[model samples]
Target: MNKLFRCCGALALGLALAAGGALGAPTPAGFVRAQGTQFTLDGKPYRYVGANYWYGGLLATQGPAGKARLATELDFLKQHGVANLRVMVGAEGLSNGYQYRVLQPLQPTQGQFDERIMAGLDYLLAELGKRQMKAVLHFTNTWEWSGGLGQYLEWNGYTGQPLPKNPGYSWDKYRAYIAQFYTCTPCQDAVATYIRYVLARTNSLTHKKYVNDPAIMAWEIINEPRPMLPAATPAFEAWMKQTAALVKSIDPNHLLTTGSEGDIATDNDMAVYERLHADPHIDYLTIHIWPKNWGWFRDTATAKGFPAVLARTTAYVNKHAAEAQKLGKPLVVEEFGLPRDGQTFTPAATTALRDQYCGALFGMAKGNTPASRVIAGYNFWAFGGAARPVPGQVFWKPGDAYMGDPGGEEQGLNSVFDADQSTWAVIDQYSKTIR
Candidate 1:
């Protein structure tokens, strides 16, 4: 009887290998795969502390100086054990029109693309590949900082000028206008065309198709996609589903995420959050917690507000993690940030509060509890790298160095610069613990 049982086990193992090597699917080596609330790379568990490097691709677009900085920053991140990056694939529209938009957008016109920007993205991917680093490349954004969803609407002739935070537009008006993207047929079509174009691209430097590149861990639909209203919820969910299906059809090798801010983006409805991410095509779930933005942390002093801040953050992540578990997918808190000491916008200012907050959050992922197991990975808000904000510069200008903070926000706000040794110490410590 013992001999028969051993023979049966051997046969089952052989069959599993022949089919897909225990994953029950044919996933190529070096690709990240989500399997039952965990991330696997080359059939081994993969997790890491990472950063939000939104300007990485654009940096390569600049001349030699830019490429040099890009290389140096990548090296710095790798040395600190940050093998994963969340980056913008490209921005949209002409930079001259918007006061707060990324320079060198990939889609400058309606359907036309800027080849130079595309090449920059290619270069960024090649460099990441050489370092064995992974990137989650989001194709578009809901915010005006990137000329993203609003840009598509403008191109489709839905609006004369997109709702950027100009003098006349209010936050409520901007939200209402951008929300039209979900129901706009032409706007949706234009986005699909852009998506198809990008997916079909062959990396100029690496001679690899975007769909076939192992450096890319996943393709995010959009950054912080929100429905804005209950009436738009159906359209938003449909758009997400259709986009996921489209990307999967084009490139089934890489993973897909909604780039959602969990229930926050879903109109503060946890059920809506779960339902949207429950789509079969979405490989994993994602949530972004902003204590400052959410009004959970307000006091300038860390000791005054950190306890409440930490408590709220823990509860928010735990809530989404429970939902992720129910849906059988890993959860990544891809964007979380706190300001510098006293919320200052200078690199020289201390980041003691930010450091402590980051350490506690990283601990949540590395802990042995149920929430930790479900929370497979995370990326801090922004990696400012070597870029220092110009003195007295509140927002980004054309000649100013691009930091982790986007143009829409204060340049140094929540940026983790290369000189931040204390922050790096916390990040490196937890990064080592992850793997």
Candidate 2:
């Protein structure tokens, strides 16, 4: 917090100090600090039940109706006790019929950005700050969504490859193609440039530089940055250290994290997650879980019941929590989601299993962390809010409503919408405890 205050401009610092109340410092009121293993704001312990509202940048920037929808959703979440959001900072380039592009692409080309989208992000940040809600700003991705590594690869003469959406190729081949992203010099330079651009941005509306903005709890290096395993760990870890240190050098105010999905690429070794995030610049740890993807839960194996999934998921939380204790940093299950019972895609789908899963996940964190403070709160995979999927709804269309799910995935496959009363009940109940 002191480091952050020292970086603020003298005029803003002086004014903030003059208006101080209980905090009694020049630090921005919303500045979050790592107090041992938990996060603190104004020196008071702060925990939260956040959601992945990754579509916020797209929705909030829409013409009038889009803005209204964003406002409604933000207001609703705040009123309902949803206190945190993990949103996108920007992507690599312009849209090109990509599966899950955010509504507005932040960058239209390498080293080129869209000012309107940047302003839209500025507006979103200012509004989130107004609600006293916090956000994690994730910049890039290992996936192709939002023109990620594929775009980086695309700019470097790698084209016409079988994307993840192609039925002809296996998922492994698609991931391998993306993993090659680590080897491209131009790709590496593009990400480094994008990081600098974002770090130095001065919000047009708030007149605040992004690094100094209090609404940001942390800067997530990328959404699930992956390495081509075995041979890739050393390189990936080096990239992480470089990227995290770059963010730290540019902006000393907020926290930094490697937005990695623990074990997703490393064959389920928790040590890999810890080692990848071993850098001191990485202030906290994060992991994501997809019950179905991980094969922990099978919709057709209902006869076997939920114990296998429940036990595995609970163990994951405990395993990571214990690792976090050793590292002595706060940890967050930043992403996890289960399909609704019956695995239906309809908006009316019920979430009995999802509710139970979420309850157990939240319970795992709350129960084990009181003394250790290593288990920071969870941010469920996604929140769809009031938006519905586009008609036919197989995948996203360019003009469809931004429902917080990423590009290319089936719409609302894991969204917790406004009408999911029971799900909301569980989320609200847990969120109240965080507050």
Candidate 3:
């Protein structure tokens, strides 16, 4: 057994002390404390310099290889002052039905317990602890494997196939299934158990002590949760309220954020924050955006400027940030990135877009715009991995293929890493001022 698992009895004592005397105290040794919406390391302000982690597949499967790769990646991140990692909890790659066959020994079915996945997480947490790196633990995915995609499809009465233009195939069934997924007894129990496991294993009382360790920053409820149909807003809001409460019940000290995807002020996205921000249990508000999808900027090769996109995106961010500030919380950009492949833009255009987009966004958040101090931090969509070739298209695949093809066209965001070193010096320079 891992050293941490052997000391479960000691966890209660640790929890008592953590909740009692150390409720508002600084974390032990290298750990930091959440001061309002910001983090204080030894009483000094610490803004997160983060990257989205897309390596659950390798980590959940090939233990040794995953460890080595993660260590190297974390080392690079740490060296570059990247302090946060957003890891998925019930991602498709970690679920039993999807790419994570290796976890079958632990969690044989959706309802079964998965020791392998837990062990893998333990290993990752231990490594992060060693480096004093903070983690944003994303609990669930909006993808197909965790039954979100499948459930959404089944509820809508659509076959497991392409995206439907009109999602009204079965509005009532869709809302029921969405509610069922969140409030269902078995599902809720499983999620709560998973949260407790993470808390117990990573808490300061455990030998691993990830929660108490400086490696864990916050717990993200879901990744890009949106209503499949317009009518599902009520159910989705209720689900967020309940889930946020469930997580806070176990961990009151750590921060909490909804991994909302898309613009925040918009009707579909506003409901999530409206619920979460009003709930006293939630600690922060988060949103994700891609300029191409919102039509904020034209993706043209000749006139590739992110100024328009930055203004459009930050307008919503500014509005939400102000509202969150009034609620005494900070606004976090959970996930954002520009595509380097799969688009019609040339390599030069892609590179220009990446630099200009990142520069403009970072510039705005760094006080160049009106919403400077209201914005907290951002985690670029991805890092590492090679580009995957699209089957028949000239450009590469667009998003990160964490499980399927790590070397495929998914590495478009790798440009962010490169740009951070060279063209995007302003981001690094501005990040210093924020902390």
lDDT of 3 by residue, 129-182 (tens): 788887788876554434443433343344433222224535344434454454
lDDT for 380 in candidate 3 is 68
Top-scoring candidate (TM-score): 1
Q: What TM-score would every model get versus the actual structure?
A: 0.94, 0.90, 0.74
Give one digit per residue, the lDDT tens place, for model 2 in 1-435.
234432542344344444554465455667886655667687466778889988787765778897888888899999888878998887666656555555467877777888888887888898898899889989887776777777888888877645665667677677667767677778888889998988889988899989889989999998887776567766777777788888899988898888887776577766678886778898888878777877775655632667888887767777777777788788888999987777776778778888998888777645334323576667888989887876566777777777756767788788889889999899888888655
Q: Which clashing pairs does model 2 show?
A: 99-407, 99-408, 100-407, 100-408
Candidate 2 lDDT (Cα, 0 to 1): 0.77
Could you tell which candidate, 2 or 3, scores higher by lDDT? 2
**Could you give candidate 1's per-residue lDDT for residues 1-435 as a string of tens digits?**
146643753464455345665455577778998867778787566777899999899888889999999999999999999989999988888866677888778888889999999999999999999999999999999888888888888877767444456767776777788889999998899899999999999999999988889999999999998998788888988998999999999999999999999898766898888887899999999999888877785556656888888888888888998998899888998999999988889988999889998999889876456687678799999999999998987988888888999887888988999999999999989999877
RMSD of 3: 9.1
Estimate the lDDT of model 3.
Answer: 0.56
> Model 2 misses residue 42 by how many Å?
0.4
lDDT of each: 0.87, 0.77, 0.56
List runs of model 3 lying over 4 Å from the truth: 1-34, 60-63, 92-108, 145-186, 202-206, 262-272, 297-305, 341-350, 368-370, 385-427
lDDT of 1 at 269: 91
